[model samples]
Target: MEINRRDFITKMSAIAALSVLPSSFVAAMGNEKVEKAKPKYPTLKCDVVVVGAGPGGVPAAIAAARQGAKVILLEEDNMPGGAPVDMYVPFICGGPRVGVFQEMIQVLNAKHTIGGRTCETFGKTGSDGKNHWWMPGSYAEVIYQLLEKEENITLMCAAPVVGVKVKTSGNRNQVTGVRIMRNGDYQDIDAAVTIDATGNGLIADMAGCEYMFGSEAKSDYNEPVGIEVADGKVQPCTWMLISERIKRNAILPIDKLKGSSAVEDNLNRWVKADDKEDMIRRDAGIYLHWGRTVYCKDTRDPLLLAQAQQEALERLQENLEIWHEAGYAVHLAPKLGVREVRRIKGEYVLTANDLIAGTMHDDVIAHAHYSFDVWGMKIPEEMKHIGPYGIPYRSILPTKTEGLLTAGRIISATRIAHSSLRVQPICSNIGMAAGTAAAMSALNQTGLRSIDIKQLQDRLASMGLFDGLKKK
Candidate 1:
């Protein structure tokens, strides 16, 4: 009996879903709802595919490759280094001391691009001590070279992932591949496992995974740092700029400026940069204090983006003029420093309590040591502690999505918990864990949830990471 094209396609999709879905999902499919049409596109197959070649995506690709998987890394930008190159956020926090973090510090030191510890505002060293800093150019270049050294990793730039190919079986949805735009055409790339290191939860959102944006109420997660009401309001994003000191004589007189008297009034107050201790501490000419912030929730709105950018530019222009008198010219940041965005709901949602307690989990794969640093938001009492939190393997696992895991700032965490984990070093560590887990899942022909947590932890330990978990 000949079947109709629609029927045939439906049957084929079921077969594909059955081939890849976990046992639990397959068992639940008997009573599952309607079957949907499978996507059709030009295809490429790989062991694993990672989206967004930022700080997280880069390390993720490298980790999967080092695990002997054929990996493809997709980036929307022409180059990698999403934050450093695109966002111009040159700060690398003291998060992880091991694994890729150590390698990065060593590389920066060897290249002489590592700036010694810097003090708060005006470049003055704080009594609390200084933290390491590096030029974005050097950091991006080193990351590129590192990716190049990995034979198993294929880096694709200017390829933005637009959609996800999900095969739903029973209660679970498995991401078979991602639909990406390439050379003005859409194409499908299949993978056994896909890592969402986009840092904005873009892949997870497209995959129909459960996620939350902004803030959650304290009662929701029993979070001390949560707000009284869940309003999704998060810390604002900053537009950072680079500057260089020039001779003071290069500055034009305030009377020669073209602006309202109100603008001039503010400029007069802000231009006193010569002896202000608030302005003189850093060796790098980059000004951290001179930033205009817009909420992350409003970041994607075109009108909001335009308005925020204009405000940021106007503020930057004023700072430039002020610095011009103090001998500094400005270089604007390429992208805004977005502090928070979509927090994908994962198998385990880490909370502020866990971070403050430095809770250890048996399945821990990575570690983050950073203070709960929230910009433009009240720091709750629970977030005030200095912590070395153990990030478990479950933190990156999407709650209902099979064949997918998260890395970077997009991992499963409460808004307050994320404030600490979103730093560069911690994100890189999470990337390595996600990549390693993806490789294992692909090689074992198992869904990401089926991979043995202990085995994954063991692999990380062998890689000279996850040692912190031993103490617990």
Candidate 2:
């Protein structure tokens, strides 16, 4: 502690040396740098290229592959399951009958994750008595694997598609392929047909399709209550968690992070508030009830992220301690729940009215659920859950994107309707439609508009999407 000029000079010299050496080179100086290793093989390609590895993209990729087309499923993360494996989103709906979706369930009954496909919950009865469903999780990975291992399908993990280029045909536009972003490099994927299952509608939007966002005000698309308009108020995104193999079977008890103001105390709390009219019923593991929740502020804009990170950690720990005292060993979830962001507007804009009215389309291809959920612009500090809705094949087929089709939350729907139809079962149904539709589109080499609806319907019926509620 009493070292003087000699030691100080040596210490300053070391510091100066480190400051001059490039960061990575400094590590190499002390055998700390990790040498980059090259892959044994080169890049791969496919006929169909799908971006995003979310629940929606998984099945769409599979459907495309099963259709005898070479396919590539690209996921940004190294792993595949989107919300379940990454965001810990629970619940999968949209199924009212028997099909591969159901069969996939029967196969995954043992593991918490179906066949290691990300999923949650045991079987739950539905308002539609005919359906018994579980919220699928890593199950998407199972689905991804099943598709990728097929002779025709390939998977590109850790690749994110950031750019899109569209080619035009006679009055119809086609997506020739996508340019995937991998760090500083761009990966080009060329294909005849592209499925825009990027969850937030990146592909479809880039393809020059029309789109909208946020819930409509009560005066717009008339619901059971009134017409709702979607402005920029998006649903709150979930920093979700999905932890498993717990020591106790009880759910992690987290209500009010210890010293935070209670719901009653926060009469005008800016941190956590929601629409008073929104339904807050508990569905899946998430507390669907409306009221107070954590609202992490942009409290550290002038400071370092480390400080903000510490504050957030403190809040979480404070909440966790309360549960631990109550005899529940709470596990931090592996992923966060992603509620919303970026849905591509396609040839059609699906409105809540379209779902509520159950608009029959000559191009009808897929069906959805009853929940019309919205995430923002309410008085309560909670998400507004409406009932489910249905999706039509026409919604996926871009009016202009001839060689492309959209699926899942990005389909042509109003913000309110997208909220309704964006759940898992509905997303899977869209996948079903995409596969069949892709096949149809490929075989005839026609625009999606030219596909015979009668033929599509017949194909769906044959594939058991329209089969009995239970597999025969």
Candidate 3:
């Protein structure tokens, strides 16, 4: 009761220090110190683990499951459909949309066509050249139906892969599986083959695999088309949205909008005099609009992405007012449409030359046929629409990494080459190839590189994946 001021201060500091300590240690203040235990995460085993249930991951999961591998498909979002469901990018851009992708598109065309056009050609290339897109929710429905049919696939939604379980030795990494966040704790999902289909190459990057981000100079890769000097700049992010005609008989204000494009359900640009009457007669109320595009300071950073989205929304206010006056309501996407991210380094980095020359690699796993559609850069007119080119099996196999494969737009490719193959169809095909290879590797108990390329090619060929290459 007669404590001095100095003693009181000293005693308070000691109590503060003890308060920050663990309860067990604090309880043993004058006794033997207790050691803190390391956190133990629940571990789940599977034959193959596919992260990100977007265009690439979904197909990868389905393909692997079809090949008799137990697949655990994880999606960060609550639903499975990737860009289409999440980003409102429901339009199909690239071609050679065969294999599991073709199947999905066929289902979308038959059941989910919003343009009031009957699709006569089922599983036909390009759906008989009829450009079409579905409502974003339709894509989710179709994906759920397709995924449900697969008995060997376990679809886990709202599960994000936060880390990779990698074994490293002398600059070489063997990805055993991935760790996901679960119930405020970490849960490990071990697999024989792990597919980095996160679209950002997050898992591969975490696994200590080398990755290329942003633009590389033309001289660096000897690419046919790219900037002379490397800029490390990625394509601008777009905020995609859909506008619906709310009021009856209200004409779409396409001419007044400066940045947005009003398209028909068939994805055909709405021409003023050419098809206005026909469009109104069809009662096509919904139109996909490219809301606003802005370059993010650093796309890899979530905060930067959010800032870019805010900037886009600010820029979109004028368009939003215009649409409201035109009796239309807009539905913005859940996330910004990111065009590029980490392109994980692989055995072979595909270049624009390969796309232009239509190089059919000996181990071609997928054929991508799309125009060079660089958002910020202007490609030559002739170089715009190149012939069908092959995506080799080597391109999906990350260099110096075993049991890990890259899928979607994250596969190794120069910026110019990525502009061509980064679309949904091409990505889906790549996912199919990656999934099949993953299944093969898991079932055979062999390394990814040691798998039979010839057999893989034959399997893809049988699925009509090579049909596009044959047409050329």
Candidate 4:
């Protein structure tokens, strides 16, 4: 007799619960101690394998599952929700309502508000908008529940993809399978299609696809803005800390706290400074400017990342104690808010010119309404506040790699353009398209480039997305 997935999960959970029982409890039951057996691992196969499970990968997994494809969502963290929930980003950024962004607003009960305060104009007109403030941990639960409803989707947390198996066909290479590390055991996942929503293009790198890192030369795309040569000084990562006001309590001064001397000095200076941003208020007793910007050569480097995390925690601890004395409860997020990283070299590379001119392409799959909001880079004043532009399907397609597609911040775009499209809503849109494309490719036994673009657009339209892509 065959068992269903639900039954398997229930039995596994029961075994897990029993394994953790106290020795005394087992002895009380008069059961003899038995030697434990080694864990059994099995090879898994799926129609689609999506890595990252962040804002982008979550939707990708759901979209593929909705298409009746078996999907494996691999995440490095214990849960989904990506930067918005993990890093405690207060609200989703303003964008056109379509696709997952529209669905998420309805499902998550998101309210259109500014700075957590109600605004009739912005809410009614629905121009520039942000969701009402929410805790990341709570929002993570919402994302988890959403994924759980998809019977075809299997979400594995803390299971990182260690390798991508690739095979060369004549001149180009194709991904065959992937190796995953889960609980000191290696598991192989063979998929018909792979989606690289890893934010930093980790799978693409493992597949040996051509990719770009940091900023590109202004001459390369030529719309003006950004560094002249490729460099690692793309954007500074931020650590967001949350705080709430309460009754006053006894606490020590900020100097005695175990914080970086430089951070402590900055706090001391801010105390006496009169020209601080509105993010800090004396009456509020809680500061939102607690998030710190840190410059690191490589955000992926374990040593550098650890240092950044340590610095963030120290700053958080120092502020929490200071705020505690002033009647506030402050806490820091466990994840770092990374902005920019690796971008796959796709069939078409969207540039700042495309964004500035609001260019529409023949293969437009989605649209973005944002500017080149690059931080830590020298962006020209004229390059600011660009209007809506269409994102091409070719931009998400790898140039020489087959059987794979990349979305989210890893999509093909110029450095200036990435800063605009790297937000949650836009990334979700890209993920939806990628997932659909992957599903179609898997079902038809075709490569990504061979998928019927018009048919894919029609499917998206039926699902109430891809309004920007008009059928010819």
Using TM-score as the measure, the top candidate is 3
Which pairs clash in model 4?
none
Q: Locate the minimum summed-lDDT window of 10 residues in model 2.
A: 23-32
Mind giving the per-residue lDDT tens digits that candidate 3 earns over 1-472?
0111242233335544555321111111121111132216667899999999999999999999988999999999999988888999888876776777778877887787865333323224746556578899999998999999999999988888776665544445567877676656657788999998888877776665677888889988788788988888889999999888899987666667767654554434453424556655655578887778899867778989999999999999998898899998999999999998888888999999999999989988998888898899988897798868889888999887788998899999888999889999899999999999999999999889889999988887787877754543
Ranking by TM-score: 3, 1, 4, 2
**Candidate-wise lDDT, in order:** 0.69, 0.53, 0.79, 0.67
Per-residue lDDT of candidate 1, residues 338-379 (tens digit): 777778888898988899788878888887778888776678
TM-score of 2: 0.68
**In model 3, what lDDT does residue 455 have?**
92
Using all chains and alpha carbons, the TM-scores for the candidates as numbered come to 0.80, 0.68, 0.87, 0.79
* lDDT order of candidates, top first: 3, 1, 4, 2
Which has the higher TM-score value, candidate number 2 or candidate number 3? 3
Candidate number with greatest lDDT? 3
Q: What is the lDDT of candidate 3?
A: 0.79
Count steric clashes of candidate 4.
0
Give, for candidate 3, the lowest lDDT window spanning 10 residues: 26-35
Model 4 CA lDDT for position 130: 31
Error of 2 at 88 (Å): 0.5
Count of backbone collisions in candidate 2: 46
